[model samples]
Target: MNTATHPSESHEKLWDLIKDIKFGMLTHRHATGMMHSCPLTTQNKKLDEDSQLYFFISRKSELASALAADANVNVSYADPGKDSYVSVSGVAAIREDQAKKQALWSAPAKAWFAGGVDDPDLALLAISIDHAEYWDVKESKMVQLAKMAAAAFTGKQPRMGEHKELNLS
Candidate 1:
């Protein structure tokens, strides 16, 4: 991906793409320094703003342990139909705010906790994103296929433009 654009503009475009996708994969660095990723739901208090943080796992999953030891994290989202993707980097921490928890809570999430939102084991994971980048590919699949075929004839690799970079610090 071209990294020539201003960081602010890149961040805006990435947030736009992420807003469209709604969900993303959150990655964390384990104590062993290996990275682990899991699908997570995205949420925000404001509709116009990018998700300030993503919420998942209040208790001790491997992801939670990793976050506790090291807050560094990354999240990625892509829309196949739109051919757009975004990656966000940030620090993650457990949030115990009742108001924030109530705001993000849904009945479906209760299934993961025996006492629901009231469970002592329940914890909120908050990822404070530092920066992000995005790729936009609005062309249809047929166009991509044709491009691939043409590239094959030229003995060149086909270009699939869904790529992005984010700084998770």
Candidate 2:
């Protein structure tokens, strides 16, 4: 079972867990009923009050076309060194808002979109997060290994650290 947190608190916690993780694996369902994923750099400096995540994608890419057909998506972030993993499910859409593009634009993004925020191929992808879950292990590696070994012998599941689910809907 997962612990529950207040909506705003959960949002903050979720952001805290993923903010430093450089890449999120975004999985989108293709029209042909296959799920495809790609690593996309998260663009938000901070999580929006509306619980949205943004990324810059190529308009000509298959991902763009797949999202147009089905907007539901999942984005997962992991920081193995910290033993933290987060999975966020949401609805995705490509935005054409110029002001937003300018706001999220960064110097590093210029490497891909040389024309900057005005690049024609640049598509702003926004994911309106509805639900998210995270696993954060605070125990030492040795302790975790011992628990795993015990569980293996006893045929019981090992207890990790906190696991929580957040609903933003």
Native-referenced Cα lDDT, model 1: 0.73
- The digit string of per-residue lDDT tens for model 1 on 1-169 reads 6553454555466556666666789888877888878888776534224336657586867778778889988888878777776767777878779887887788778788778777888888877777666777766799999998999899998777655555422
For TM-score, the strongest prediction is 2
Per residue, candidate 2 scores C-alpha lDDT tens digits across 1-169 of 6766577798889999999999999998977898888999999998888899999999999999899899999999999999999999999999889999999999999999999999999999999999999999999999999999999999999998999899887
Q: CA shift at 18, candidate 2, in angstroms?
A: 0.6
Clashing pairs in 2: none
In order of appearance, the predictions have TM-scores of 0.75, 0.94
Q: Indicate the residue-level lDDT of 46 in model 2.
A: 89
Question: Considering summed lDDT, which 10 consecutive residues are worst modelled in model 1?
Answer: 45-54
Q: After superposition, how far is residue 155 of candidate 2 from its true place, in Å?
A: 3.2
Point out where model 1 deviates above 4 Å. Answer: 1-16, 20-22, 45-51, 153-169
